[model samples]
Target: MSDKSKTQDEDLPYYDHPTGGWGSVKSLAKIIARSRPDPGIMQTLWRQNKPGGHMCTSCAWAKPDKPHTFEFCENGAKATAWDLTSHRCTPDFFAEHSVEALKSWSAHDLEMAGRLTHPMRYDADSDHYIETTWEEAFEGIAAELKQLDPKSVVFYTSGRAALETSYLWALFARLYGHNNLPDSSNMCHETTSVGLKKVIGSPVGTCKLEDFNECDMIMFFGQNTGSNSPRFLHTLQAAARRGCHIVTFNPVRERGLIGFANPQSPMQMLTSSRTKISEHYLQVKPGGDIAVLAGLCKRVLELEEEKNGGVLDKAFIEEHTTGFEAFAQSMQQTSWADIEQASGLKRTDLEIIAGMYANAKKTIGIYGMGLTQHVHGFVNLAMYVNLLLMKGHIGRFGAGISPVRGHSNVQGQRTVGISEKPELVPLDKLAEMFDFEPPRDEGRTTVEVVRGVLDGSVKAFLSLGGNFARAIPDQGQADPAWKDLTLNVQIATKLNRSHLLVGRKTWLLPCLVRSEEDMQATGPQAVSMEDSLSNIYGSVGKRKPAGEHVKSEMAIVAGLAKATLKPNPKVKWDDWLGDYSLVRDLIEETYPDDFKDFNARMFEPGGFYRGNPARERQWKTESGKAEFTAPKVLTALGELPGEGQYTMITLRSNDQFNTTVYGYTDRLRGLEGSRYIVLINPKEMADAGLSEGQMVTLESAVDDGVERRVADLKVTAYDLPDGCVATYYPEANPLVPLEYHDQESKTPAYKGVPVRIVA
Candidate 1:
């Protein structure tokens, strides 16, 4: 390493030491500085999850049935530690801190205040949030909603909302006569749903955890299962021990892909022995996934043609799919030179990967945000499906396309119809069931919702969960749009940056966390979540109430509906909220063939698996087969900066999830105490004559002039690809222009933002 690069590493908070293990003592200090932990809250949190009552809702991964030994991960602990805080945002507290003053505070400082004690409203004159009665808050919101055109209202659902509440909210929106539903999914995995549906006729993954054990080769693309989905580590370790070939392709050399210490394995944990995960690691350039996937498909076709005179599942392709010839022709036209240059991979590496697929009997392709958060996200996903189809890798155990979701119920939310654009069949069924006309017009997506708010077309914003302002990109634009809203309602458990960005008239309604006991008229309620594998399971909170006034998310949604649309007798929102089973009954009515015995199935230890058409190789397309989409011309890749500017991909630290910053420590990347540094290659730093650890500024290279410039950012030299740098999200989100999104998926190209570094 160059002296400058070595200097940069030495200046990092944790240097090159691992985050956990003996280095934890120093890691803890860094965490304290970054998280700004409150002592009183830590004490209360420590007392939580004691022998009897409940577990922390935020860290539900702790196996409740097992011994209390393994309770949380570092990030999970931080979440609980933050929540158990003693600080309260009382009316007096708000009185002292003006909204303007609070805006200037860091996101960490604003959220450190435990929770909102009572309902509050944005008082423009006082420039603070004043506590108000629940009745007045509800009445004010109801009156404003009643005055606006129902279509002008946008309902936003965050991943944090419970199944019961999400269902009620969706129902309320439909009854209110609008389909303008925008949620967290739009910003994350909207591409997963769109692409999967087009290829397999189902939005969910086909493989289950059980299939993970049966697979011969597991190809993980664009996912860091260790940090994003740690629970899968055990499964991957087991598969590796069983001699399964594990291939991982990602821009970052994730520690999890290198290996993992199974916490459950007594012998391994005692010895600190780690299991090898990936047999092969391919570091594809950011935004180069499409070319890589296309290359894989091209090689697969050649192998089929040479070995078996075109053995590519001709029967399945001819009978079930559309546009295969066009797709195949496009693949053939992609020259190896272009593929190698675009994908940052040589011909030999791709051939080895192709050979692995050819030899393996069963293969599974799993991916996460790296594939979805791009300009051609949908096309990239479709190419994966195409490769799987080429090898006849569908409809079998351990073989399918699995998009690992972040939040537990993210997939379930979509499964239960939390979409802006409802399918024709579901829409028709909903209209028939409610005895009212369902809106035919498609609603605005997340990006569109923000645009609508800016243009004054949207009147009300009702978010079920999530810190919207902090989660979205181009904050310079999104922040102002949020403030322009006439009414902004947030149904949440804790205060966050979104709450601080209060609108003209706002209501902060506190709700129950998922890990807390939710008591309704029918008694204690149990919710269900569908994991990434499409296995539905029951999740019951065993913890006591944080406060008596805290209402379940379902009850809050029902209450809001009762106050706003109770006069309209067409919908029975009250009946459904009374018992969660009733909501399941409604789901049964909507998807009768699939959810026929919803209540009965949910009672089972591991809930029943939803039928996946792809699992059976049953493609429900126009031709009743899995269709192939032709690849677009590789012209856009030329648009990226090649000379002076470099592309900066924004990513989350292992310590953070979405917009929720648990702490400042990134164990794998050797980062600690701060999240403002950018990772760059030593060669690039030297070529630019830049000194390590020197503060620098970044400006967008795109012609849109979105003005996303990060100033005084510390530079850290690391083993990154040339012409590429990386920084943490939300902080780097400003560098991404809303217009610079996937043309097909509308997902912000958060992974490949072209930027210029300044001294």
Candidate 2:
């Protein structure tokens, strides 16, 4: 760490202004200046979220049918500028920095070094990456893969992969006779899938983009809309303009939820005026979402007793949902004292929130990682569904659940059959189309893959995109295990720390990003992605490829498939490589209901909605109806932090998206120049005898005896709940044990790790 990275307690600036507006605009400009200026960034911005434009490569917020001239947000612009920058990480650059030295560089420095220009292999002797031919790389990877058992290799996919690439990647895995497909969702929103599936019969959110407009109330559960999904702020601002109640339940009162000034709005930009959001904001504990939700439900049930039949939606419950009686009985038995202790909110506050929900004719419940990245994330989601079901929110116009997904197409990748559980996919249909028997046995997830590698069971690993080492929890264990792998391959646009985790035969294959033109033998091609709201849209990059050697993710997958698998007459890899439409046709054949006319739909105004069964009231569960779940416990973690320990909430800065850090400044949180600081409540800091700007080490409180700690982190006092602290993710991920995760979903409990600060 440099001296410039050090912080002074008195020098910390408190941001009194609203989020977005000029601040967001200035931040984007700063990033553009820091990164080599790209002249075409504005042109690319104009096309983003438009009919024929590329999807914003950041958040999965749905694109509107009739979009604005600039549909991207400040964070979206940063992503674009970051991708489109002229800086290149060519072989010459690699010759200068050794792999070991590069490992010590900050994540932002590594990414800013720029896009990889050619295929390269890690030379163990020289400790540097040397250029390698694509053919040699493919042949080497294929040879190793052929030697290893399919079950011993893991194919990791990132959410950045479009549906076209993901479908082909999944097909490639199936053709190779394995289902070891662990993806980004396993580290984030797997709970949303498992929990929502059992409750609403759909793994995805039930709401559409238009729901925000017609909904009477928008309730946010642990979503930092401003930084994570800046585009969603426009919807919230519009809803606020219509007098719709905007409520928030999170440990931190994020700037986005407090107020927003849309950069695209001329009046607001000119006057520096902002729209106030979060009509009601409650600061709940880090892992207290489930308890808070239960409290809301309990208050609603009590209101029903007071008002008799008027409070409960008896018609919707009896007609479209089941298990309501059990859910209501459980809520009736919930104690106020228990709820208050678990959540840091008072009973009166919860009652007020319940009154708002009951009075609203229609409501939309939106949540993010805060609710889904915990030990009891699955139960928390189930409880959230119960709250919505009590008032008949699902399947109704403008009333449903929305999980604000990170990554551009994380949901799309899952929808295209990237799952460890093969039963979730249409294996029979795939077998019929590809002339091969698809693997039906369950495979490994992200955490399982980490354990597999550590135990020497997983010999080879491949990633379509994403920084596997940095993104996954327990990096202390997983990082060192990468060297034990027989082969490691990465298909990415830029260089990340994960690329440095070289194995015996490691290969770094460069691929074109969504902002680059994907030129195939046939013509320029467009890949499709499904947003958080199930909106499928085509993204065609207007800029030239970063390098002539950079191939599209689809082409890379096809090449690998051709190299590894024998010629299958039914599956035409060569033809699909030339024309992606052929791949879409095969996808349509496999998923007839969802992707019927998939190619043609790419030309639609904003593409099309994939259509959620729950939205139409067509439940696909065993009961054939939306079912309410009675949570066994109300707390998210089912335990309290021990004395001298606090629940550590992992977070992302304004300049970050997932593991990709564009810069260190988190302007929204009044943080700058560094990402190594921790936020603690002032009262708690005093209780611990810790001064602001004091360097401390955070050690995991788990009894695993495998000490996990991050040292040299400066502590700063902020407005957080007692016994809770916050730190940047990836940096703080080591404190979260790989085994400590949601039991049902296997999603790491990144947001709620118990740790103690040592001075």
Candidate 3:
């Protein structure tokens, strides 16, 4: 840890103003100045999130049917500037910095160096990357891939991939005879998909952009809107002004939930007036969401009895749901003492929130990674869904559950069948279309892939666009395992730490980012992205390609498929590359009900919503009704923190998105210059014999620990629940063991890891 001055201590001045306003404007200006992006950056910014322009590459919040002239937010601009940066990591730069030397660079510095300009191949002897032609690169990759068993290969997709690219990737995987298609969703929202699909018959959220307008009450669980989804702040601010009840449950009192000042509001910015969000804020303990939700359901049941059958929609419940009697009995049996202890909240506080929920005719529950990155993440989601079901809150105009996804097109990737589970995709339909028998066995997920790599079971790994090694849990164990792979392929727009984790034969393939125009034989092309809501939009880049050598992601996958797969009469990889609409046609054919008129509907203004059957009261579950789950355990950790230990909740800073560190400063939390400091409750710090600015190490308290620890972390005091600590992610990722994850979904317990701070 650095000195007090360098550490950006807790004593630093707090950001008292609202989330947006001048703070956002200045931050965007600084990023643009620092990146010195291409001349077309201004035009690109103007077109972003508009009807016919490129999608914002940050969060997947839905764009309104009538979007603003400028729909991009501060972080969205940062993502765009990141992609459009003038700095180029050309062949000469790679020649100067050896792979070993680049490995030492900070995550932010590695990306800030610039966009990759050409295809490169790793020179194992020299430990440097040398420029290579795309032809040679694909040929080498194809030759090695042909030798490997399909089950040994993992096709990893990042949220950066568009619907077109993701569909092609899945097609290539199945056509080549494997189902090992793990994606970024495995790390974040896999729990949502697993939990919701079992209960609601749909993996996606039910709410649309219009729902926000009509929703009477909105409850946010562990979602930070300001940093993660800034554009959505406009919607929140409007809801607040309309007098909608906004409740929040989180470990930290995030600035986004407290209040927001829309940067786009001229009068609000001029007067410095802010829309106060969160009518009520509850600081729940880490891994306590299930308990809190159960408590609310219990209270709602109590209110229902008090009101004599007026509180719950009994008719809807009886007709549209199953297992209510058992679920209600489980809630009734739940003791308040247990709920209070697990949630770190009072009975009165929960009752008050429950009262508000009962009064609201329609409600929407929004959440993010905080709720999904836990051991009981599946149950956490199920419990939330149960609460909505109790009141018939779903399948209506303004009522449903929304899991705010991170990445732009993560949901889109999965929608296009980028899943590891063979059962999730329409394998039979795909086989009929492509004339190849697809693999029926379940394949490796993100964590399974890591284990496979380490055990020498996985020989080839192809990443469509993510920092896989860094994003996954237990980097200490997973990072070096990449070298054991026979081949590693990264298709990206820029350099990151994951690119440096070279295998026996590695290839860095540069591709066109979302901001850059993608042209093919069919003329200028547009790719589609599905938002957190099920709405799909066609996005066409306004700017030219970063480099002439760079190709579209779809094109890259097509080339790889042509080179790797034996010639098949039915699958024309090149023809699909020439016209992405052809890919959409096949996708529509694969999932006819969801993607009817896919090509035409995708280009519509604000795209089109692929309506979820669950939202229309059509449950696709086994019983043909919304199924209720009665979890044996009511908490994510299954227990509260023991003495001498605190639950650590890993999070992202305002400056960073996911594992991509744009800068070290977390201005939203009133900290800058460093992200290595952990925020602990002041009393907890005192109890642990630690003071502000003190250097400490956090050791995992798990019994199966193989010395999992993060050393030299500076401790800072903050307002958090007792026995609960907070730290930035990727840095804190090591403390979470790979085996410690949701039992059902396999999503790593990143939000609730038991750790003790050592001075």
lDDT per residue (tens digit) for residues 383-482 in model 2: 8888898888999999999999999899998998999998799998887777788888999999899999899999999999999999989998788888
Q: Looking at candidate 3, what is the lDDT of residue 278?
A: 88
- TM-scores of the candidates in the order shown: 0.91, 0.98, 0.98
lDDT of 3: 0.88
Query: Candidate 3: where is the Cα deviation over 4 Å?
Result: 1-13
Instruction: Report clash pairs, candidate 3.
Output: none
Stretches of candidate 2 exceeding 4 Å from the true structure? 1-13
Candidate 1 achieves a global lDDT of: 0.73
Q: Write the per-residue lDDT of candidate 3 for residues 514-566, one digit (tens) a residue.
A: 98888899899988999999889999986878788998898899989999999
lDDT of 1 by residue, 701-726 (tens): 88874567888788887766667899
Alpha-carbon shift of residue 660 in model 1 (angstroms): 0.7
Displacement of residue 166 (Cα, Å) in model 3 is 0.7
